[model samples]
Target: MKEHLKHDLEQINHLLDIIKKQGVEYLKLIGARPTSVNHIPLWETQNLPESGYGTEETLKIFNQRFEPIMVGSSGPRYLGFVTGGTTPASVAGDWLTSIYDQNTQSTIGQGDISANIELETIHLILELLGLPDSFLGGFVTGATMSNFTCLGVARQWVGKEQGKDIAKEGISGLIKILTATPHSSSIKSLSLLGLGSNNIVKVKTAEGEREAICIRDLEDQMIKLNGEPFILISSGGTVNTVDFDDFMEIKKLKEQYNFWWHIDAAFGGFAACSETHSHLVKGWEYADSITVDCHKWLNVPYESAVFLIKEQYKILQVETFQNSNAPYLGDPLENFGYLNFLPENSRRLKALPAWFSLMAYGREGYKNIINQNISLANQFGQLLERSNDFKLLAPVRLNTVCFTLKDSEKQDEVGRFLETLNDTGKVFMTPTFYNGHSGIRAAFVNWMTGENDIQLIFETMNEVITQLK
Candidate 1:
């Protein structure tokens, strides 16, 4: 045995205690940590030693090399890119996930029940979102992968409509996809699936400063398809202003059309927890597939999201992702393994963090998180509204505020303003372009964010603008 390995095993408890203490200190000081930092020079890579260093020494080296530049992307004032902070319960589950290191590939006859736990966690998520049992869901790394999985199945279903198996035989001819203001991740998914992103028929958004789909334009595009089967990718909440497509109208169209409907709910799906905002997603339950991100509004750790597809399309999903040649893995239909349902052959117990979070904070608890974040967002938006130096690009639709310089002629200054604001290390926001004008977007998804944080951000923004002037 390696000397370092033996030493690590013997002192595992002490090693873990050190890690626990480090984690506690980081979490305790997260709010005060810098949200952005200037680039630090990388540590020179070293050749492998003849004998490995002991675990404690190795950790010390890592801390010295990398810990200083670790930014506070998960902290309260990180209002950038719809980032969410980890909950205490989620951190607990994440730690256990690494310790156990279980491969969550099957629910039965696999000598592990972690997959069963994942299935139950999916059920709990559906219940929380007020979705019907008709939908079956599985966890993936993030919204991008979730979108890929759903659209992969959609591609197969489109092929099936023409009596072809695209998964086995490869993409055949043009597969039409229609969307208005789809996220970049969805376009990336199309490219990954061999469905050309340029092939998407860009539907028109609603009039004025809206990002929502224009129902009339969508209907016109459907007519142009001339009865050919297609896929419609809709947004539950857009990233910048959190604009939601009219799901009720889309549901009506689904009854008359033969196209598959998919919704990229991502962070916005949490609106179901708000009685005041729940109406925004009234008919999303009817979607053929839905993507939701646990790392965003759910306040779980990074790389956690779920893709929910209708139970009726289980066979299609299997066709899209089944490991057909592996006889030892058993029949996908009869035995029922998640390995045959989604992407990736080997997966961690990715559902654990989400399960712990949902269990620790029930429906009411999530409701509070969602509502509180929304309130904070509106509070920030109100500040932007009253500020003489800034102007809102759109109303606070959900949990994001899109604003820009009060003078449209100073549009070129948006990036500079954002850079200065982010450099403050007091708050972080991302630059955006909206309605032909450059803008800055502050998304409120972190659970620790409150009125105090908003006020701090507001004051900081004013100070930065004054400096810029």
Candidate 2:
């Protein structure tokens, strides 16, 4: 055995204590940590060592080389990429996930029954989102994988409609995808699924800087399809302005049309937790498949998201992802194995963090998180609109605020302004372009953010703006 490996195995508790202490300290001081750090300089490091440095020495090396560069992306003011912080219970669950290290495949096999925990977690998630039992879900790495798995099933359904087994016989026939303002992840999934990314037929968005699909235009596009079966990729929340499609109207159209309805509700699906904002996703339960990101609004760790596809499509999902050739693995149809249901054949017990978080904080607990984030988002949006230097690109719809400079002629400075502001290290935001104007989006999904954080964000913005002038 390697010297370091044996040492690590024997001193596991000591190593764990050191790690726990480090993590706790970071969390304790996260509010004060810089949201953005100069990452380029941190790239300097030695190549792989000839001999192992042992766990303790290796951890010391890591602390010296990488720990200082670690930014507080999970802190209160990290507004980039619709990020969210981890809950205390979720962190505990994630640690156990590595410790237990179950392969998380089948419920009935001789292997660990961690899959049962995953199943229960799925049920808990459905309850949290007010979804019906009709949807059978599984954990995937993130929204990208979740989207891929869902659309893979949708592809099979599409093939079934045309009387062809695409998985067995290869992709054939045109699988038309109709959508307005679909997320980049879904488009990437189309490319990965062998469906051309450019194959989508774009429907018109709703008027007035809205990224949501115009229901009238959507129906018109469907009418042009002439009763042919197709796939409709609808946005539950657009990344730029956080716009949601008219799910109720889409449900009405489902009555007359023959198509697979997929909703990429990634972060916005948490709206179901808030009574005031739940109307944004009124009819999403009718969707054939929905993608929800746990790391975002659910405040779990990375590589965690769920794809909720209706139970009626189980056969299609199995046909799309089944590992039937492995005779030793048993019949895919008989066992309740996630291997035959989702994308990856072998996966971790990815549901633990979600299960722990959901259990620790019930519906009311999550409700507070969602509603609080939304309220903070509105407050931040108001700060932008009231400022002479910043102007909102859209109304604060959900938990994201999209805005740009108040000076239209300074549009060219948007990127530099954002870069400079991020360099300040107090707060961070992402840049976007909306309605022909460059914009900045300050997403409010972190649980730690409060009224004080909003003031700090605004103050940072003003300082940056003044520097640019």
Model 1: how far residue 270 lies from native, Å: 0.5
Please identify model 2 stretches exceeding 4 Å from their true place.
42-45, 326-334
Per-residue lDDT of 123-150 in model 1, one digit per residue for the tens?
A: 9999999999899889899999999999
Q: Which residue ranges in model 1 land beyond 4 Å of their true spot?
A: 326-334
How high is the CA lDDT of each candidate model?
0.91, 0.91
* lDDT (10s digit) by residue, model 2, range 229-252: 899999988998889999999999
